[model samples]
Target: MPRHFRALAVQPKWHAHDFTSAAAFKAWMRSQLEMARPHLTTNQPNLVVLTELNGLPLVLRGGRWATPLGTFQRVAAALFVGRLARTLPLMWREGVSPIRALQLADADANTRLYLHTCRDLAREYGVYLCCGSAPTPRYSLVGGQPRRAPGTLTNQTVILDPQGQLIGVADKVYLTPDEEAGGVDLTPGDLSELRVFPTPVGDLGVAISLDAFRPEVIGRLEEQGCTVLLQPDANGAPWTAKEGLPPDPANLRDQPVAWLESSWTASTRGRSIRYAVNPMVVGNLLDLTFDGQSAITGRAEDAPEPRSYALTSPRPGFLALTPWVTTGTPEHLRRAGRERAAGSGHPLENEYRTDVIWADLTLPATALTPPARTAHEEALSAILGGQASRNPSRVAPGLLAGLGILAYLSWRGLRKR
Candidate 1:
């Protein structure tokens, strides 16, 4: 029998104030789903997809002073001061930089607030939920509870069944420059560990943010017979901004056009993957700004040639695309800032301008059979059963204690200055 389902790509505009507490974050997430409720059908399976780094804001949880800050640097500084006791020790114990340590300090809280909330929401809506990626250490389920496993932090995405049980996780295989050593310092996941999770809707494969740009990542999943590709994204640059000239400089294109070539165009042009959902996280996190038009792309039998959209020129295979309030140029951004400072708010700054783009998709009949578990899946299953051993640390305890003391003294001296 042919299976049909509704897939929703949720474009969320995040604000610093939303991460003030776990309750606030969950409430905000619930409201996003509420907006999609009317479009969902009771007769068919539903898949709810969120954007990448949507859960990254939860690192500000419990840090009241940092939640209101306007820039990433300021927020990080305030968070370090407010959670000094916890972050300091983690930095020394993990032998990682301050930013990485802070992420580690809040890893458990992030996991609980993010996954548990998604779990509850999935159960409430009876939808398969893909809780987007977060910058956190690997965690394994022990005794039916999530426990932090010893590992470097990476961008990880989790999928849940309609009953809210965890189906699997896919960590990002490619790391952008910012995610490398000098920035957030996240570790890259091995591409060999990718898994295709089978659901009533389709065989879903997640290729997070930059990972989607890589042909190998998409090819591996296609080889596994994945019918639906979820590309959750949070572009660090403006959507309208023109990137540097490519190898063929004559074909100048904006970020959206380039992204489309790698995503929608790639998936639809003679590919077996039936559908691709790309959800984007927009809005500002101080100096860091994320902006992109969330979209759903697929191949339709009777569909006409693709037409031009707001940001991109004539492009095919787009099923649905969200609209943005502004063009996001430097001048437009400056004007928006001036308007906010003068007590008149710009529509671009409205965090409540959330959108959910949905498309009804038909799946191939062969997509129902679940594939055999790969080796990575077997290891994940063992970890869920609490049979996996914790990784041992090589650093001496006394050396770590000394480093902690030194870091504390440096922090105190900087404050004194």
Candidate 2:
């Protein structure tokens, strides 16, 4: 069998429920991370890239907290702040305190702390945890400021090793006007350099979601000698399982192989860049997209054309590869962090656009080439405890089985009442 590493690309969705309160957001994050962990361990890919806005809180306001939330909260109800306020008293009276309400008062404190812990957990599990689709730049004209493209403080991507230790951070440098169209004052980050780090497997490049849409980010990664690109993003209408996608719970139509191919070729044809098409993988809780149809693509230096594959079974496992050279930082991130820490928002003054194009990367099973299974597989297999003996149809067969049972009981009580 060919040596194949699996990448668990994750797109963690934070809906209104996720941000209603700090606790909710944190709990949601923990749950998502836990769910994604199994896949990460089983499919120890070269790298695990998350393509969602996990690092930052989408704040909003209302409830007893009476706090203003993150900009993402604005994306929730189309209604304005005034409208959300009207319903606040009702929620407070009825003892309804959403997670977003708590986030507004203490945004970074808990968020950063949670992220720090999450990174550690990821490292402990031996899965590379990468966060993307965080806050980026925005087109804003707040506080009588000039209508320039300013660095809007949004979400950020966090990187962790198998032990979930903090490896690096990637701040998004692009933002779409529509994302910030209903502005409560937003800005954009600089068009910074791509950030790469050395992993036990190979050099990995991580860029913001929108940044990947541009040839520059991918080219820069290749220039930096990256063998894999891990992109974690939350995008578009919920995905469907057609056209090559794994089964989408949302039941939306999909364009699988084409989706997978677009990500694989992101940086393959850029100027001053001469790396063969590095297999780009995208991950989310429910989906895994690979560029080459099969997991086993030829060596990085010699991949076959029109790459495709076929698989007889659904083989999702934890994977890992050898590590390579890791070094360097994005000048903008350092400068911005320093500037923000020093209370000088000078870096926030710039005009730029972050347009991210997501390509679906679901290939047909037959087109999939299985990667080599190593001790890494055995390690994850041990962790999973090989519960295949049970019926796979039972969704919450693990620890969550208890929660499912509890929910069932609660429902029975409510119906009786």
Candidate 3:
């Protein structure tokens, strides 16, 4: 019997400085742990996948006026080093005891440092760590720079066993201009190379967030003997009438499920998430945006509902999953059958097959202590927090002065209505 495992998707609020100043980032990360600890201590999900940090870091190289608008590109470079120093320890201390396997969305030069640290942390926790690097610049010529495409970009999902030795890697095979831009040229990985990582849980496969959106990608993974597909991404943008969602879109719809050409993940036969819709981000409340319902869909034993978890869900939904390595003709036969059946099930893959055992993953909700806001963050958070916080007094003064007023006068009704 396949054991049920509790799994949680965490998208921590991160800024440029977080990784640059490991101490500060660690402290902030520790505080956020309070929000997740209850879930881990209670639900004990066997897997935890953390979202990559997305905010632009402060300027790193050029003069402020000459530099780009996003963030210090260098900060992305520093991320791995910071993770090694601070974040990885937290994983070992908290997640390691309960969460047996962990994954993350990797970005930037710091990714190198982060991977090395993850290797070390895997040892400390006696757990496995898997992370994927972002695609390089997407455009053939980015920011007026050009380079040859590398067969594989740095930071493919580098897998480390409990002893922290490198095992397998899944380089991304698809590329968009954005992924190709900003720095080095990226080479998409071979699609045929996608395979499962034998894990303590089961034969596991991971498709980075956007990777999951491509039915072909997930199909290939499933075809290659993968049982569980873990997709980690950073999503949550303004909704459009054209966008169609509320995510659980069982009834309402332009389409029951949201589909975007640029979505982070898609699968051939099982479930696909339009976006990570957890409300962990501060602006999410006002914008009504969310990322990290980290929604999952697959059939396991016909439960009343396909398994799903909110970041705030109760714990113990996951159990300690031990994947005993098994290799046999039976495994091969199963894989072949799945592969043959894959694309028929969807357009993305030609043929793919796999097995999955499901169980409830209940994670207890913990009190969320919002991370302390720094002065620099006030601007970003204000937009997310709500429009109500905008200075009403300032608006009132301007209104009283009739500043920059544009009014229409009607014959009978000239009111501000």
Winner by lDDT: 1
Candidate 2 lDDT over 218-323, as tens digits, reads 6676666655565554432212223322223254333333333333344344332222212222221111111111122222233333332221111221122111
Query: What lDDT, from 0 to 1, does candidate 1 have?
Result: 0.71
The sequence of per-residue lDDT tens digits that candidate 1 reaches over residues 221-325 is 888887889998987765556664333446766666678765585467636688888998877666666777788887744234564334555556778877655
Regions of candidate 1 where Cα sits further than 4 Å from its true position: 141-147, 244-253, 300-302, 326-353, 367-417
Question: Global lDDT for candidate 2?
Answer: 0.37
lDDT (Cα atoms) of all candidates against the true structure: 0.71, 0.37, 0.34
What 10-residue stretch in candidate 3 is worst by lDDT? 96-105
lDDT, candidate 3, equals: 0.34
Better of 1 and 2 by lDDT: 1
TM-score of each: 0.82, 0.47, 0.46
Candidate 3: regions farther than 4 A off: 1-4, 22-37, 41-45, 52-109, 132-155, 182-186, 239-256, 259-268, 271-292, 300-303, 306-417
Candidate 3 steric clashes: 56
Report per-prediction Cα RMSD to one decimal: 6.1, 20.2, 20.5
Tens digits of lDDT, candidate 3, 164-236: 5654555566543333432223455567766665554345565654565566876776555555566545434
State how far residue 165 of model 3 sits from its true place (Å). Answer: 3.3
Error of 3 at 200 (Å): 1.2
Better of 2 and 3 by lDDT: 2
